[model samples]
Target: YMHRPAFVALLVVLIIGGTSVGTSAKKAYNYRMRERDVGKSDIVWNNDEYVLLKNGDINKAYKKIEDELGIKALKISVVPLEMKYDRLEIREGIATIKFLFNGQLLCFIQAKNDIASSNNVVSDRKVNSEIYNIWLDKQITIERNKLSDDQIEYSMYLSINGAYYYLYGIMEEKEFEDIVSELRF
Candidate 1:
């Protein structure tokens, strides 16, 4: 009957949608892998697939980094332009990203290596270099009656190599002041 064709078309649409959803989930997995790989470092390249937003101003770059990462920064002082050598293995690694927002002092990142072999490949467990990443579903709840809803929601990320640890949280609070004070840059 005429209805048979419509039913078959509906089935096809469902199949396509399911496949698309699966592909997106796979992409998310790969993205997490990439984030763990290119953690905070001293080399000057952003292989760590980030969503970039630009509005023709350098401050756009500063805002982009802060908004995406949800970290606080403090712009203390600007250094005069000077030529410096980049010895890190990372290709075109950012030597210095000079900007301060929130209260994070000397908030800049650099790459430590230049292993840019797999630019387009989707990350998979089969790939040997995938590092351990934080669980997305799990959140560390801070039990503070004084804190607001926004303050209670935080996640801790352990570095891939376990060199450093990070916690993303809101500013305008005293809890993070101690950590921010220790930053040298």
Candidate 2:
């Protein structure tokens, strides 16, 4: 009787140990999958609030973003803004969106008048190029002056991802810093 009891107890210990190991492995797998899913679904930048010219289809992305934000289709006429450095094609109006973090977001949608036309069809390449150039010039300036150096003089830095989509216009360093600071994400 004593021997049998001991044998049963030993068997129970081995079973419990095996079950514990299996459960631990299963838990680990579950945790890893959850983390991966979160990473895959991460939203890096805002589309509607910010002027995002993504690598994907610009019109499709713009439409979807516009609908999501409940914003109307932006009809713009480009206005030539004479700056100290160069003449820039500025969007006639500025759209302000109250974003999280007590921050105000400013989006400039180029007006039709501001953009030059070749044959009445708006040239996307031209627009993209103009924006990109402007973004680059601004980035260089921002890099030269660190944020800690002057908070008042801080210029917005254009999101690198956004700049990639519109790579044509000349950007002042001050403008790039200003844009980057405005971005929430």
Candidate 3:
């Protein structure tokens, strides 16, 4: 009789443990599927002057920024601003998203402005290095400055009708260039 009770208890414990494991596995699988669906979606904002393009995983993007910068106060918020040409009203200021790829830190900035006004804002004066071409034959002016004995900062500026973008980070030179090449800007 005692053996029978012990056996029943073991079976009950096994059943409960199996149910818990299965539930956890299912939850993980669902989370991955959700992430995949988000990655396949496109987020865009279009107007007469320009279009802003972003991935559907905006929350994930913000999370990346928080993780990379170790900042907890950053929240997704819109700022109102006035543009120079056409008196274009900007409802958003800038979006800063960071990601880590192949052990490199990449920061992406997305902003929108009138094409006419954006043209006037492009200047190579701040860039410390020679200009190079990237996506769509667009010129990328780079500036690198030493921040400390072991660290360096890089800034890349590019303007397109879709958006006015800036990427700045402290990383390896080759990795920075690689990330710039992948930008959709």
Ranking by lDDT: 3, 1, 2
Predicted candidate 1 versus true structure: per-residue lDDT over 11-73, tens digit per residue: 999999999999987766563323322454322223224322111133344444345434332
lDDT string for model 2 (1-185, tens) is: 69999999999999999999999877655522112124445233321322222222323434443454334433111211221111122222322221111131223332222234321323322111112233234322222222343422222223233221111123444454434433221
* Candidate 3: segments with Cα more than 4 A from true spot: 1-92, 100-106, 114-134
lDDT of each: 0.33, 0.32, 0.50
**Candidate 1 to truth, TM:** 0.27
Q: Which has the higher TM-score value, candidate number 1 or candidate number 2?
A: 1
Model 2 / residue 92 / CA error / Å: 31
TM-score of 3: 0.42
Residue 50's C-alpha lDDT in candidate 3?
Answer: 26
Between the candidate structures 1 and 3, which one is better when assessed by lDDT?
A: 3
TM-score of structure candidate 2: 0.20
The count of residue-pair clashes in candidate 3 stands at 0
For model 2, the local distance difference test gives 0.32
TM-score for each model: 0.27, 0.20, 0.42
